[model samples]
Target: MPRSATDLLDLSELPAPQRREVRDFVQFLLTRQAGAKKPAASYRFSDLCGTMAWKGDAVAAQRSLRDEW
Candidate 1:
């Protein structure tokens, strides 16, 4: 049998309600993936896409500078 990432994520040890929560959260994350370089995700209270912008390594370097420290 082939094992996908989600097949193992559905741990049988978890309770029914907890299992449902896990399933829903996983689906939510899949939907949130906006085909960007960043792995950032946010929840939407309203029916709107929580935008994810991917500013790459330049931002990280700036943040790590002495002035930022």
Candidate 2:
């Protein structure tokens, strides 16, 4: 029978160096997959956005609060 893509690995058959190489490749693929995920839409946070926009110097107010902390 043909082995499925998810067939069990026989790491014991691989040389130590080859096993390390395979492990590194798997990690690389996982990292690439994580970064390839689509970002959320620009309007995803639209509702919570303008909720914090005030007319005054919000940056100065934030700095002052941070200094107090």
Q: Which candidate comes out best when scored by TM-score?
A: 2
- What's the count of clashing pairs in each model shown? 0, 0
The C-alpha local distance difference test score for the whole of candidate 2 amounts to 0.74
**Where in model 2 is the C-alpha error above 4 Å?**
1-8, 38-69
Candidate 2 local Cα displacement, residue 13, angstroms: 0.5
* lDDT for each residue of candidate 1 in 1-69, tens digit (9 for 90 to 100): 896446767479999888888888877777676455576678675557566666778767777895675
Worst 10 residues of 1 by lDDT: 45-54
* Pairs of colliding residues, candidate 1: none
TM-score of candidate 1 relative to the true fold: 0.40
TM-score of each: 0.40, 0.42
